[model samples]
Target: MAAELYPSSLTTSIPNDPAVTPSSKKSIIQEPDQETEPAPTSTQPNANSSTETGSRWQASHPTLRERNALMFNNEHMADVHFMVGSPGETQRVPAHKYVLAVGSSVFGAMFYGDLAEEQCEIQIPDVEPAAFLTLLKYLYSDQIELEADTVLATLYAAKKYLVLALAKACVAFLETGLEAQNACVLLSQSRLFQEPELSQRCWEVIDAQAELALRSEGFSQIDPPTLETILRRETLNAREAVVFRAVVRWAEAECRRRGLPVSTANRRAVLGKALYLVRIPTMTLQEFADGAAQSDVLTLEETHDVFLWFTAAVKPALEFPAVPRTGLTPLRCHRFQSSAYRSNQWRYRGRCDSIQFAVDRRIFIAGLGLYGSSGGKAEYSVKIELKSQGTTLAQNRTKFLSDGSSSTFSVWFEHPVQVEQDIFYTASAVLDGSELSYFGQEGMTEVQCGKVTFQFQCSSDSTNGTGVQGGQIPELVFYG
Candidate 1:
């Protein structure tokens, strides 16, 4: 019989040799087939490997900022072009298709989904040309110096393009930079963009300056839902009577806008759900009688309830729940130690405070405080250890110099320890450097350490078995 032929796409089959075994022949074919597969096959498995070696390699891999910086700075021959701006006036920005696709899901879907974008050119008409350029810089460099004037617009553009990291950056900027002048406007913008954290921050700001916020024109424009949320808060620095009066002003403005009657019932109707949130019980009888009770905004039944509660005639119709634990104090996230501390020998620094990390992060020194002109400049040898149950789990050591010009300094670590979730650990430092220059009063900072405690102070005498000298604590910062 004649041998059968094979198609070009398929490999040619070899005839069984008279001297060869089937099993050995199978092994030879398998090895060649692996080599024939695409180059991506090897890398794909490595990307998802569970081994520690693989994890370390993945963690150390270059970030988007690093890759983008190298590509744009060195001009790696961009493959895509964006024709951005108004009609008849536009700018062409060069970018790599791979970078854009990786940075944004929107870009990824547009480039490679069911409707693939063509290779030639693309236009972004909605995003401001300048802002879009800035977004590209952030997308590539992993950093942008955001300013108040353009941050909101930049955020809008980022959200439009589905660049979550950039959007988050913009939100963070707005959060820290929010001021009385812009709080109301930011509140409105936050609602429009569905940024709950920013909105909550605005509310917290309002609580601090409720009277001032009430006087702002945007106060009247606050949507009814937000109004209720603010009114329901117990910690509104202003008295209940003050907020009740503001409620009346807001309601009156709302009524006049609709050309409705300015009567109390009509005002109450306009106030809607917000009226119930006011804690009428907290108001003094004199204030309620002269203010809230007389206002057209509070209903007769609600006013009666207020009057009865103040007189102890009856319990309030509804109890006021505590101001849903107002905004977190700034100190909640970080500890501040203004005093100076000195150390002559290596020992655990101070009391260990329990640290509960909401997210797994690697913590590093935020600043190394050094005293005199000569104090901060010297390179200090230091090592930090994280101990769990008296065993050292992780450690990082390096030579660091404090910024000579400034009291606060930052240093790069040679080996930053990886922290995991729900692990109880304490941090200790070992130092062998020049005697640190300190203030008149020695300050002892605390850390979250394991269950080991030692009675030691700032003494260099380690000649005895029990004596340990205290060490200076470098203010630590955490990163994920």
Candidate 2:
């Protein structure tokens, strides 16, 4: 069944349809209070502006009292009704046409245009009541209070109503909170809403923390097109095996969504063109033999071709890409401006040189950038440890040879250590060498590396001269 669905000669290229542009539709609007002042002729005020003059001017306006009365208070004043939400869980909200018309041109056209409908109630089955209420609050008071759970829905309502300010605010809020756990989901939403800036930011997080992003529950909820976009990302910092597992998880979720049995054929069917984007040929022979081959998601011929490609002198053309991804390039968060080797300074006698650091977002700490021997060619034994509070998270014992150069040598851990956000972690390194080496001077308290900011402070564990202001521990190498 799976082989009949997917042929071996299937091309990798999948045609992407253009983004759907949301069209403005006419909606029902209730009548306003008899005592309510006439609606303003001008467009909505800039809700994001914080200027004192604008605030004072709006405060002194006579329509403020009318707006307060009409806000969500649908007593005898409402003439239009909106039935929002899905069946069996619908909510009817009463709104004044004048207020909505003043806030949105879409509403104005809907209620007052030449071909406007005189319907008393409108069916809005796609939007949630909470999102609609949020939009109303912004129109009435020029203030927006957004929650994490409803922000995306609110963004949808704002876009539907052509509320540009609220949409921009929602995008900014999402960008501020973006992490590996939610990047995939946000990437899906950003693409859906045509938010290129937010999409780019989400991609940054996904690429840097691809392993964590792919393992998140949100990854399974992403649409097939977003899944294809992620699978085709050559810079994703994850192994091909991890990508395969994530794809399988997404396929399972898709199966459950479609009410189909979670069988191998169903998974393969749901995957379709996305399966070809997984780059199974890039996985090691051991990975293929142990995982993909056993999963039974691929046809027998496809599995055979993979095995032959691994062993044959002349490999056959496979559907999946054979080249490995470029993966993430590590960025160095430098803590100091210059390096100096004073006669009395930079001498290490097994004392730990530690600095406390924290990041605004989650990242993987690959290793540290440290100064080597200042004297002629020499070898030094080094021990590095990372700790949060009093508990140790990661530690490594390694050795490095240094020539009489000013370059800082990279000393890495066995594996990258995942660090949480805004929590202080201490990175300490103790070197066993008699020769005096270069120490970092004029240390910085804050260093901005790409989108992630590294905040440094003096750690109590710094028994050596290393501090945020001076001593050792020149740089932190990490992937965001």
Candidate 3:
């Protein structure tokens, strides 16, 4: 009883049922964990697995992580390499982050239109590989970024790659920045490229639009020499000389218009220089005529003499068929047609021979022929006649030389010799070289004896020799 009273403050604890075992209690306390980590399976690794294993950890659950894991771990994830620094360089960068350079911001903008619509976003991956790097560099630098030597290389590559927009943008940059000299250098270098259109556009922008090129001010201008080089490369066309000559004419005209006082001598020298430079047809007819006109400092008569010299230059060209005259015979001696009788034909019958030439609209006849066998040297004349209105073209004279005068004395005749009244015939003895022999054979009379050809004029006034007469109609006969 006393023990029970003393233990009241610390009463001994007792099992409710006294039947529960230690193992059973432990099992009850370790009830199934609500948030236990997943077990390591063949298909799933622990989140805190080894460094190699932990890399497999993904942000989402097992299904999503497993789906993307294979793709994310691909060995070829590295981006494509892109060239940098300059168009022709070996340095490269990742394709995704690159930019391009262009000359004019506007030029690049213009290229945007010609480029395929989808290409505008600058999706470098989708573009042709060749232009990608260069175009990217252009975007970044706003320039071609090619060395002077490598510009041609870049252009060729761009053209070959069908990156026309990039190629044209590069060309525009070069044309705007490079001087005429450098522009010419580029042209000479790219004369045989695949992009003729590009080259031509470059030239128009550089050379034709340049002020010095238009005015052709200096002796050392780049355009002239540049053109010379181009011509040497290709077969120069003849018609192109038209444009070349036009440039020359414009230069000369401008000089004059500006009161530059270009002397005839200086102008000629410049023209000759230009001709030589351009390889134009040497000594053209127009050039010769203009040069000759300017150079001849002489009086009207002296100028006429000079003109005769000029005419001689073109005689072969202007020569017509000896003023065609046919069926003209002295006294209608058809027998003279025989080769045997022709030798002395003039000795028996009369023949008329002379040339009617115009000197300042005045007609004169000078030639010789036998009047008859007995007349001998006494039958010849140096005659002058006035031309009538109806003569449009000159007629040829066909007559043999007289027996007395040497054959070298063959005459070039002109007008028809008719001894009729209203037509006052002027004749003189060939032997005397003197005395006016004026004979008047009139009244329905026809003097049809001629060993030579002659031209007849239809006149209106009878007494006016210098004036035309209007009385009769002359007969003309052509045998052959």
Which candidate achieves the best lDDT against the true structure? 2
Q: lDDT, candidate 2, residue 437?
A: 90
Summarize candidate 1's per-residue lDDT along 1-480 as a digit string, tens digits. 221111121122211211111012110011121223211111011222234124253345345343344343122356777776656757676677777787788888888778979875788655555557657665555545454555666677788778877778778767655544456656766776789989887765665555566666556655566677667666554667777777888787777766887886778789887876766666678987998777766557766766776677546765433233342221111223343444542222332212212223222222222222225466556555555556665556666664443253333232233333444445444544544443222233333422211111332222211111122332343322
Question: What ranges in model 3 sit over 4 Å off?
Answer: 1-150, 188-191, 194-197, 202-229, 232-480
Per residue, candidate 2 scores C-alpha lDDT tens digits across 250-291 of 999889877899999999999999999988988999999999
Q: TM-score rank, highest first?
A: 2, 1, 3
Compared to the true structure, candidate 3 yields what TM-score?
A: 0.22
lDDT of 1 at 293: 77
Q: Judged by lDDT relative to the true structure, which candidate is superior, 2 or 3?
A: 2
My TM-score estimates for the predictions, one after another, are 0.42, 0.76, 0.22
CA shift at 377, candidate 1, in angstroms? 53
Where does candidate 3 have its weakest 10-residue lDDT segment? Answer: 1-10
